[model samples]
Target: MIKVGVVGGTGYTGVELLRLLALHPGVQLEAVTSRGEAGTPVADLFPNLRGHVDLDFSEPDPERLAACELVFFATPNGIAMKMTESLLNAGVKVIDLAADFRLKDPALWEAWYGMPHACPGLLEEAVYGLPEVNRKSIADARLVANPGCYPTAVQLGFMPLLEYEGIDLSCLIADCKSGVSGAGRKAAVGTLLAETSESFKAYGVPGHRHLPEIRQGLETVSGQQVGLTFVPHLTPMIRGIHATLYLQLDDPDLDLQSLFEARYRDEPFVDVLPAGSHPETRSVKGANHCRLAVHRAPASNVVVVLSVIDNLVKGAAGQALQNMNIMFGLDEAAGLRGIALLP
Candidate 1:
């Protein structure tokens, strides 16, 4: 069994890691870290996980985490970089769910994240962990950078088209909507129920932090520079993400339906719905599945792709666990085989 450790265990993503790992047959959770909640019982804090994980939260310590075979960093953007190098030296595989190591360029990363990278040298060593696209790299990597919520949905939706020749890459637009939980468990005025509920508005119109990450992912697939106009909206729901992608087809002969079918034929979690079908976020809630639907608007050269995932599952914690399974040579769907929770 792979002894697992999680740093920052009190937030949405942290608890999510615990929830999923608790049922993972190959994982034995060793430690969970929380500065303020140190010495608190994990079950007492999260009643939902009462009988699942029976461990106490402790303060973050690199030495304590080094003992585990694998460690997941579910902390904020800058926290993972502080300890990844030491953990790697200790021969512990690392999967980070933060934005610290996602981007390849430190300048662009720093410019958007508002601080210089703490460890730029590690950038080239960290593999982008999107199982469907970068599985081979993740399997061989010691350090995996799990993607952001928005980037995961957007990249998966457009990857099939972007990699194929004769697909117009110049005019691509991703209009995404995410739940308030995507903002994190931190208290913020913008996420307050009074402010978010009954109101749907877009934040980060053209320059959200997830933009560069999404662009980086698509570019890697296309083998060239890929640019996009991404807009993220805040919905009042608690946990889910819906991304509608618009792309232009350069080749008139390209069949949008067959293209997606042939591309994701072997993928486990990516489900391509029938043509003209629309997917709802709730359809993939609480599961590590991404439901997709493709459409070609006749006479307009426009093809639309719809993608949906639970923000905390496929978008964050679940994806991190997926990377851990790859690094350990376990089945990619080990602890994530459940269906989405629907109302």
Candidate 2:
């Protein structure tokens, strides 16, 4: 069995990993760390995991974590890099749900995260854990940097279009909406019920930290530098993301629907809806699926694609577990075959 350790077990993604990993037949959840909640029964703090996980939250001791077969760092951005080398040296695999090892350039990471990467050397070794694009890398990786929520949605939404050498890379626009949990578990006044409830507005306009990450993923697939206009909105709800991407195709004859269908035919979680279909975020709520639909303008060169996913699942923790399963040579969908929660 794969013995797993989770750092920062009280956060959204950490609990999410706990939720999914607890049900995994091939996994044995070993250690869960949270300094504030140390010595408390994890299920008592969560209540939701009552009988499923009886583990206790403990202090984040790197030495204890290094003994596990695999460790998941669901802590904030800077936490993973500091401890990654120790875990890797002990032959322990890692899947980081933070932004620490995602970007290739340490300077750019410092610019957005406001901290210098503690282990810049490992940046080359940390694989970008998008199952669709980097499956092979993830399978052989010792460290996997799970993509951000917005980047995951935006990249999945635009990947097919970007890959077509016939498509124009100059006019890519992404208008994505995400739930408040994407902000993290911190008690921010803006994410409070009084402020977010019944209020719908876009926060990051001209630039967002996720823009560079999305661009990096597109460049990986397209094999060219891409200039994109990415705008992210905060939804009043708490669990999903919907991204509407608008692109202009250089080849008007390229069939958008066929392109998506063929590209994602073998991918398990990505569903390509038929023309004129609008996939709702609620349909994919609580699941790791990315429901997508593609449409093209009959009169213009613009193509619109709608993509939806549960931010906490496909966007964060669930995806992290999926990467873990792949890294261990287990079935890619193991412990992640949950159906979407529909109302």
Candidate 3:
């Protein structure tokens, strides 16, 4: 069994990680850390995990975490970088579910995250953990930087198109909406039921943090920089992300449906729906899956792709487990086979 430890076990992503890890047959839950909730039984805090998780929340201790074969940092961005070096030196593979190691350039990371990277040297070595794009690298990586929720949805939606040469690289647009839980488990006025419910609005229009990460990933795939307008909205729901991606097709004859189908045919988590299908966010809720559909207007060169995923699952915890499976050489679908929850 792969001995594992999780830091920051109180937030949405943290608890989601615990929920999935509790049932992962290949994983042995070693420790879960929450500074404020230390000594509190994890199940007491999250009743959904009552029967499955019996471990108490512990404080973040480097030595204890280093003892585990792999440690997942589900904490806020700055926390992981501070301790990752020590853990890695102690022979522990680290997976950060935050933005700490996502950007390769320290200056760009500092510009957006507003802090100097704790371990900038390791950025080159930290493989971006998108199995569809970096599967081979993840398998050999000692450190993995898991992609953000929005980036995951947007990138996967545009990937197949960017791989070929027909689409206009510039002027890409990602109009994405996410549920309130995507803000993390927090007591924010904006995310309150009375505020978010019965309303819809966009934030970070000027420049969202995920913009650079998404651009970086797309550029890597297309072999050129892209002009992208990424706008994120907050929906009243609890979990999921819906990304409506717009791209101008230079070659109108490109078989988009065949392209997407062939691109994700062997991928375990990405589902390419039939042509003319519009995927719903609920279809991927509570599951680590990205459902996609490609469409085009009548006699138009504009191609539209709809992608949906559960922000906390495929966006965060479930993807982390998938990376763990790859790093440890286990079946990628071993512990992530849960179907989406329905009404």
Candidate 4:
């Protein structure tokens, strides 16, 4: 079993990690830390995990964390960068489920995150943990940066079009909507039930932080500079991300359904639906799967791709577990094969 430690174990992603890890057969959760909730029984704060996880929430102790085989940082952005170096020195693999190591450019990271990077030297060394593109690299790297929810959904939706010919890579758009849980388990006025429910609105239209990460992933996959416009919205639901991608299709002969199927055929977590199928977010709820579908607008050169994933699962904690499995050479689907939670 892989002995693991998790930092920031009270937020949405943090608890979600505990939820998945508690049931993961190969994972032995050594520690789960929460500075404020330290000394509280983890199940006390999260009743859903009452019987499954019996450990108490402990303070963030680097020495104790260093003893684990792998550590997952589900904390806010800056928190992971502060402790990752020390843990690495102790021969523990690190997986950060935040934006700390996602961007390659330090200056860009500072520009978006509004803070100096703690370990700029580790930027190049950190592999982006999107298994579809960086599987081999993640399995070999000591540091893995898990992709954000928006980037995971957008990049996966646009991936097939990027590789195939006749798609206009010059202009792409990802209009995505996410549930309130994507905001974390915080008390934000905008995410309150009174404000979010029965309402739908876009928040980041000019430029969001995930924009750079999404463009970077696409540019890396296609080997060309990509032009993309990303807009994120908040919906009334509790958990999910729905990304509707628009691509300028120049090749009528290109079989998009086949392209998506072929690309994700060997991937256990990505599901490519049948032609004309529209994938719903609930279909992937509480599951570590990205469901995708392709379509062609009548008489228009526009091709649309719909991608759905549970933001907390495939987008955050679930993807972190996927990376851990790859890093430890375990079955990629181990502890991740549970079906989506449906109403």
Candidate 5:
């Protein structure tokens, strides 16, 4: 069994990771860390995992974490970089669910995250953990940088268009909305039920942090810099991300539906819905799936693609487990087979 340790097991992403890992047939839960909640039973904090996970929240200890074969950092951005080097040196494969190791350039990372990268030397070696794009690399990587929630949905939505030359890369737009959980399991005035409920508004119009990461992933696929206008909004829900992507197509006669379907044909997690279908965020809630649909008007050069995913699942923890499966040569769907939760 793959011994696993999770750091910062108190947040939404952390708890999600614990929930999924507990059901994984190939995994053995080793340690779960939370500095503030150390000594608290994991189930006491999250009643959902009461019967499955019997471990208590422990202090973030490098030596203890090093003993595990793989360690997942579900903590804030800066925390992972501080402890990753020690874990890596101990032969522990590390997967960071934060932005710490996602960006290759240290300066760009520091610019957005507002802190110096603790281990910039490892930047080039850290593989971006989007299984659809970097599956092979993730399998061989000692360190994997999991993509952010917004980037995951947006990139998967725009990928099929960006790969084909008929689509204009210079003018791409991602109008995305996510549930309050994307803000993380925290106490914030903006995410309060009273504030977010019965309201719909956009934020981060100037430049969200996920912008660079999304651009970087798209640019890599298209082999050129892309002009992208990414705007994120907060919805009155608890989970899921819905990204409506707009792209200018040079060829009006191109079969976009076939293109998207063929592009994701082999990807188990990306679902391309039937033509004319609009995917809902709830359809992918609690599941590791990105459902997409492609549409266009007659004689129109514009294409609209709708993408939906559970922000905490395909966006964060579930994807982390997918990477773990790849890293260990286990079935990619081993622990991620849970269906989306419905009303």
Candidate 6:
């Protein structure tokens, strides 16, 4: 079993990572760090992992973390970059589930995230951890920058279009909605139940931090400059992301359904639904799956694609585990085969 440690274990994504790694057959759980909650039983805070995980929230001791073969940083942005270089030098692989190393340009990252990057040189070395696009690179990467939740949903919905011809790449629009949990477990009046529940409103239309990340990924995939309007909404729900992508196409005979299916045919986590089907976020809740469906507007040149994923699963923690499995040459789906939770 590979030894692993988690840097932050108090937030939503942190607990989700702990939940998966605890029961993983190939993982030997090590230290879980929380400066605020140090010495607290892991199960006491999560409850779901009461019987599975036996560790406690300890201070982030670099020496203990170095003993593990791999470490995951579930801390907020600006936390991982401060310590990743030391862990890498200690011969430990690091996967950051935050925005610390996701953007290649340190300037852009600083502008978006509101902080100057501590380790600008490592930006080029950190591989963007989207298994579908960087499977080969992730296997050999010592540092990985996990994709953001909205970017994961939007990018997956738009990927197949980039592969085919005759689709307008200039006017892409992603109308994505995410649950309140996407706001993180931190206490905030904006995400309180009284404010979010029984309401629906778009928050980051003009500029969201994920906008540049999504554009960068799409441009990398298409090998050309991409013009995109990515608007993210805060939904009342607590666990899913639904991305409705719009595109313009002149090819009347193009088989979008077949194209999506063919693109994701070999992918284990992307489920391309049948033609005319609309994927639901609940269908992928608690599973590391992106369920997608494609369609053409009747008598119009507009093409629409719907993508759904559990915000905390495929969107964050579950995808992090998927990357770790690949990095270790283990089964790609190891410890990630759980069925989606349903009502």
Q: Which lDDT tens digits does candidate 3 get at residues 189-302?
A: 999999999999999999999999999999999999899999999999999999999999998778999999999999999999999999999999999999999999788999
| lDDT of candidate 1 over 51-80, digit per residue (tens) | 999999999878889999999999999999
RMSD of 2: 0.9
User: In lDDT terms, how accurate is model 3?
Assistant: 0.96
Model 2: per-residue Cα lDDT over 1-343, one tens digit each: 9999999999888888899999998999889999999999999989889999998999988788987999999998899899989899999999999889989999999998898889999999999999999999899999999999999998999998877888778878999899999888998899999999999999888678888889999998999988799988998999899999998887878878999999999999999999889999999888989999999877998888999999999999889989998999999999999998868
Off by over 4 Å in 3: none
**Candidate with best lDDT:** 3
Which TM-score value belongs to model 5?
0.99
What is the C-alpha local distance difference test score of each model? Answer: 0.92, 0.91, 0.96, 0.94, 0.94, 0.94
lDDT of 6 by residue, 136-225 (tens): 999999999999999999999999888777888889999999999999998899999999989999988779999999999999898888
Clashing pairs in 4: none
- Of 1 and 3, the candidate ahead on lDDT is 3
> Model 5: which residue pairs collide?
none
Q: Report the CA-based lDDT of candidate 2 relative to the real structure.
A: 0.91
Q: TM-score, each model?
A: 0.98, 0.98, 0.99, 0.99, 0.99, 0.99
User: Can you tell me which runs of candidate 4 are displaced by over 4 Å?
Assistant: none
Clashes per prediction? 0, 0, 0, 0, 0, 0
RMSD for all candidates, in order, please. 0.9, 0.9, 0.6, 0.7, 0.7, 0.7
lDDT of model 2 at position 197: 95
